[model samples]
Target: MANIGIVIPAAGQGKRMGAGYNKQFLMLMEKPILAHTVRLFEESDFVSEIVIVGAEGDISVIKELVYYQEFHKVAAVCIGGVLRQDSVRAGVRALSPTIQRIVVHDGARPLLTLQAFHKFLEESREYSAAIMGVPIKDTVKRVDIAGKVLDTLPRDYLRAVQTPQIFDREILEEAHQQAASAGYYGTDDASLLEWMGHPVQMVEGMQENIKVTTPEDLLLAERILTQRR
Candidate 1:
């Protein structure tokens, strides 16, 4: 088994979800969204430890969930910083020294499967970094600030990125440190490496790996769960 460490960033305010709380705490079927996400790693053969990063006030709640849910893979509950990248940095800092590889996943994306996890881990062995994403199917347009369509982007070359981005521990740490020193925050972990001139591979991601960002997304997740059952 690989000495892989997973960092789940769940500290978002989730104002768009209109849940008045962290979306990770929102129920998907009978389980919280965070629980569902964590369960995937718990059931994964490649994951060795998990560090959940959340708001300070919610740290206890996450710890309680880990205990009651019997998620033995959970090694720590970290208090997140203001930004998503900052929270990810905190989680990275909390990883055990034995961790050779790091995977950063979104807590709201609970549709990830064990197969995806395995695939990402396997790719990590060959590449310094790899991320899961699907090719963009919609016609993409480059619009200006005034909302005028500038040009049609080549959809064939575009990808809609998702989480469980895998990275070697050294590369991830260097990326994070460089980002902090440069005061630069990328859209995701892979972007950080990209900014550092690192090459990252994109693996095929499941279409169902949707992120629960809005109420409609939550409903869709519920329907997906129902259909799976």
Candidate 2:
């Protein structure tokens, strides 16, 4: 069995959510969104450690949550940076040195299933990098900066990527290091690997495995939880 460490970047202000605070601190069911996400990994059999990277101001709250919840797998709570990528980088550095695999996941995504987690981890052993994504069901259009439609993107060739993206610990660390040296910024953790020419595989992700970013998303997340119950 591989020793896996999960890095959760939860420092975003989520200005779009209009919550006036960190959206991860918002309530999902009876618990905060961040707590729900942490509980998932905390219960995973394959995960050996979890490092949560959040804004410095929220570190105390995160620590209190972990302490009160008795999240034994939570090994560290590191301060985050301005960008999401920066937070992930900090989390990677904060993980236990023994961890062989790294998983980067959004702290607001609470609907990820154990099946997806297990499948990604199993498949990652064969591939250096793997992530969960869903094929686009709706037609997508490529537009210019002025909002002029340039071309219609084939949905077949497109995928809406989600987390948790898994990667070999060394590979991810190297990718981040190279990206930093080159002054490159990737939209997601896997994009950094892609920039390094790493072959990344995708695992089919559930549509319900959505990031809680907006008020509408929160409502849907509640409905999903209710349906599950």
Candidate 3:
């Protein structure tokens, strides 16, 4: 079995959330949002260690939460960098040499399931890089600033990507290195791998695995959690 390590980036300012504080630290069903995300990996038997990357001044708060919650698999809670890619790089650097596979997930996505995680790992084993994504159900259109539809995209080729993107540790590290050297900033982990001429496969992701980015999203997540109970 591959030694899987999980890296969660929780350093984003989340300005779109409109919250004064970081969205990951916001309350979700009486627990911090990021805590729920971390607990999922902590309970997974396949996960060896979890590295949580937070903002510079936010480390103390995350440490408090980890101690209070007694999150067992959290091996390190390190400070993150300015960009999301940089933060992920910081977490990857913190991983032990024994970790053969790495899964990078969003700390804001508290609803990620074990099944999706397992699927990502299984796909990554066959393909060097794999990410969780759902095929777009609605017709996608490319719109201009003037609200003019430039082109109607076939939904078949469109996929809404999600987190828990798993990859072979070496492949990901090399891709990150290449991205850094080229000064290329990718929107997601798979983009970095793709730019390095690596094939990125996609695993089916659940709709419930949503990243809570706005106040409305938090309400929906709360409703989903309530319905699950």
Candidate 4:
């Protein structure tokens, strides 16, 4: 098995959730959503190390949470940058030199099943890069700023991408380096790889793997997590 390291970017200020603080700190099932996410990776035998890139103000809280929870896998709770990509880059830098495979997962996505993640890793072993996604069920449309439909996108050609995106450490590092030079900002890490002409494998993911942003999403996540238990 390859040595794995995880980068969880939790620095986003989720204004949509209307939470006074960072939404990841919000309680979910009697625990913070970030704790749930970290614990999931901490419990995994495949993962050797984990780094959480948090906002400047949240670093102290994150450290306290890790210390209290005894999250041994967490190597550091470093300060993040302005953009999500910058946070991910900072998190990646915090990993140990021994880390071979890197997994980039959202800190808000606490419902990622270990079984699902293990299966994804297994299927992604042969490829240098792979991402989890689910086929879109709803009809997607390209709309103009004026609220008129520009074009209807074919559902078959689209997949809603989710986190726990895995990549070879060296290649991922190189992609980030090149992307920074080109001033290319990708929506996801896989997009950075694609921009560099890397073939990314798409593995099937569960619909429940959602990045919690709004209050409605939090409720749904609780319901799903309750069902899992």
Candidate 5:
């Protein structure tokens, strides 16, 4: 139960965020976004250790934050690659050999409340692989490059997938290896498993579980954080 290891991929440059630096370093309610993300798992009873994958330039920054915050669960801080997939793989490799389960989450998404996190963890225990996703509440559409409506996608089967994707260590490692060997770059970790013919269960996620990609997203996160507080 305490063998669960969490990998946080914080290597994204956040070019769209226009922060002129890694957005995860940006403060949210007086703490770094990445710090907020890690603290959730650190406080959880299920997680035993953590591995953070960051850019080469941000390694010291991340290490400093972990030390200052007294995040004793941090096992390693590894250099990440250009792609998110590569960063996740690096983090997975940093986990201890005894860790039988892995949870990969985005460092920018700091608003994931402990209640939701533990709920997902509890409900996902019966599955080999599980991910959090929210049902698409809005009307959907499929459009072409010319802005022409091709077809209206069914919202009933659509979901906006969020992170903290949980997987068995052995299967996740194998999925990464297969993807690397085949030169397949997937949109997310679940997609990699999907490509490898693995069934991934989708548990209901919160609407506020959004990844901060732009400045607007940061503002929205702030509001949600305040509300949560």
Candidate 6:
């Protein structure tokens, strides 16, 4: 079995969440949102180690949370960079060289399931990289800066990508290196790999696995948590 490590990026300021504090540190049910995400990986039998990349000032808080919660699988909690891609790179670099595969998940996505995680890993075994995504239900339109609709795009070919993206360690590392060298930044890990001419497969993701970025999302997350419990 390949040594699988999980990289969770929790350094985002969560400007959309409208919360004074970082969204990851916000309360979700009885615990912090990030704690729930960490616990999920810690409880999973397939996850060998977890590396969390957080904001500079959040290391002590995250460490205390991990210790208090007794999250055993957490191998390292390192400071993250300004950008999301940079944070992911930091987490990936923190992983042990022996780790063959890595899964990058969002700390705000607290509802990620074990089944979805397993599926991503299974897909990564066949494809060098795989990410969770859901087909866009609404019709998309290409609008200009002035709000003029340039084109109405068919939703059939569109999929909203989600996190918990799994990749072969070497492939991901190379992609990050290429992006850094080219002074390029991607919105997600898959984007970086895709730009490098790597085939990135998409696995259907669950609707419950949402990134909590707004007040409405927080409410939905609470409901999902309650239903799961």
Top lDDT prediction, candidate number: 5
Instruction: Give the Cα lDDT of each candidate.
Output: 0.92, 0.91, 0.91, 0.94, 0.94, 0.90
Q: Which stretches of candidate 2 lie above 4 Å from their native place?
A: none
Candidate 2 lands at a TM-score of 0.97
What is the lDDT, from 0 to 100, of the residue 76 in candidate 1? 94
TM per candidate comes to 0.98, 0.97, 0.96, 0.97, 0.98, 0.97
The residue pairs in collision within model 1 are none
Q: In model 3, which range of ten residues has the least summed lDDT?
A: 115-124
- In candidate 6, what are the lDDT values of residues 81-105, reduced to their tens digit? 9899999999999998888889999
Q: Clash pairs of candidate 6?
A: none
Candidate 1 residue 157 C-alpha distance from true site, Å: 0.4
* Candidate 5 lDDT over residue span 64-151, tens digit each: 9999999999999999998999999999999999999999999999989889999999989999899999998899899999999999
Ranked by lDDT from best down, the candidates are: 5, 4, 1, 2, 3, 6
Per-residue lDDT of candidate 4, residues 14-125 (tens digit) = 9999998999999999999999999989989999999999999999999999999999999999999889889999999999999989999999999998999999999999
Can you write out model 1's per-residue Cα lDDT over 64-174, one digit (the tens) per residue? 999988999999999999999999999999999999789999999999878877876775678889999999988999999999999999988899999989888899999
The alpha-carbon RMSD values of the candidates against the true structure, listed in the order shown, are: 1.0, 0.9, 1.2, 1.0, 0.9, 1.1
The alpha-carbon lDDT assigned to residue 141 of candidate 5 equals 93
Alpha-carbon runs more than 4 Å astray in model 4: none
